[model samples]
Target: MSNCSFCQVIDETLRPGGIAIWLMKEAKEDIKYQVPFLLAVYLDENVYNGALNFNPWRWMEPENEEKRNRRTSPFYAPFGGGARFCPGAELARFYIALFFYYFETTYR
Candidate 1:
């Protein structure tokens, strides 16, 4: 969740009225994922879209307006700052560096 800007905004926007709408939207999205899982059908579109976009490979360009909007948005902190920052960030960075180190060493 550290890399999720949406989660950070969600944290800040945890007010009474705002929280209701946020939870409802999140619940709807979760239900979309859950209903298919309850059925035996192996529909993969949503799962694939979510995972592939998160992957380093299969990179897709963002729309120009979307990029500009993100740049201007105050709630778009990819990583939270100050004392409330992500705890596992350093560990994640270390693991990523180690993975690359091992990959380069072994593959070369």
Candidate 2:
């Protein structure tokens, strides 16, 4: 019953934010870091029909109650909190800002 936009995005046929490469890289890294957690969101039975007919677009559905709640609720903790926080978080932010700065200067 879903529109299957996530499939399109995954297949490289659709670019939601014009940043598919960035998204793909982040997704791949996330999967590597926490496969089970990512699967919990991406492979949940209620969000996806089956392993074969999987569709990540269904993530928008209310049926994914846990994910929806976590996304909307402020009670949830940030990814990697306290001393276990990501070491690359600051570097990633800096690189992203530099990318935007250069992109804007070069393109505009």
Candidate 3:
């Protein structure tokens, strides 16, 4: 019941502070990351539900779209965000698309 990004790469042999793109505001009031923050927490249930369960239809629904608050709703941002966003994100997606396309054509 988890789709955690940190956990995903845990088996891939990523050492601590290896790919340090993920960052978030510190809860320590005045303190913040001088380098990169390693963990990001979501204190709501819906975000977890979105990832734990597979419901692709929610993404296409207008009702769900309007209710999507980043803090509580489910959204997939596999790569980190802003300046640290994965430069290979597009490349990864492209490879996935090609794999599916080839698989479908071959198997169809």
Winner by lDDT: 3
For candidate 2, the per-residue lDDT at 58 reads: 38
Q: What's model 1's lDDT at 23? A: 15
Top-scoring candidate (TM-score): 3
How many residue pairs in model 3 have overlapping backbones? 0
Off by over 4 Å in 2: 1-35, 39-79
lDDT of 1 by residue, 1-108 (tens): 233443333322221112112111246343444321211111133422332123322122242123112223222222332453456645644565567568768994
Candidate 2 local distance difference test against the native: 0.36
lDDT for each residue of candidate 3 in 1-108, tens digit (9 for 90 to 100): 123332233211221122443545547576644754332322224433343333444434554443333223223334554565678855664565567567768994
- Which should have the higher TM-score, number 2 or number 3? 3
Candidate 1, position 93, lDDT: 44
What is the C-alpha lDDT profile of model 2 across 56-107, one tens digit per residue?
Answer: 4534556543432322322111223245445664454456556756876899
Clash counts for the predictions, in order: 0, 0, 0
Off by over 4 Å in 3: 1-45, 48-50, 63-75
Q: TM-score, each model?
A: 0.28, 0.30, 0.45
Better of 2 and 3 by lDDT: 3
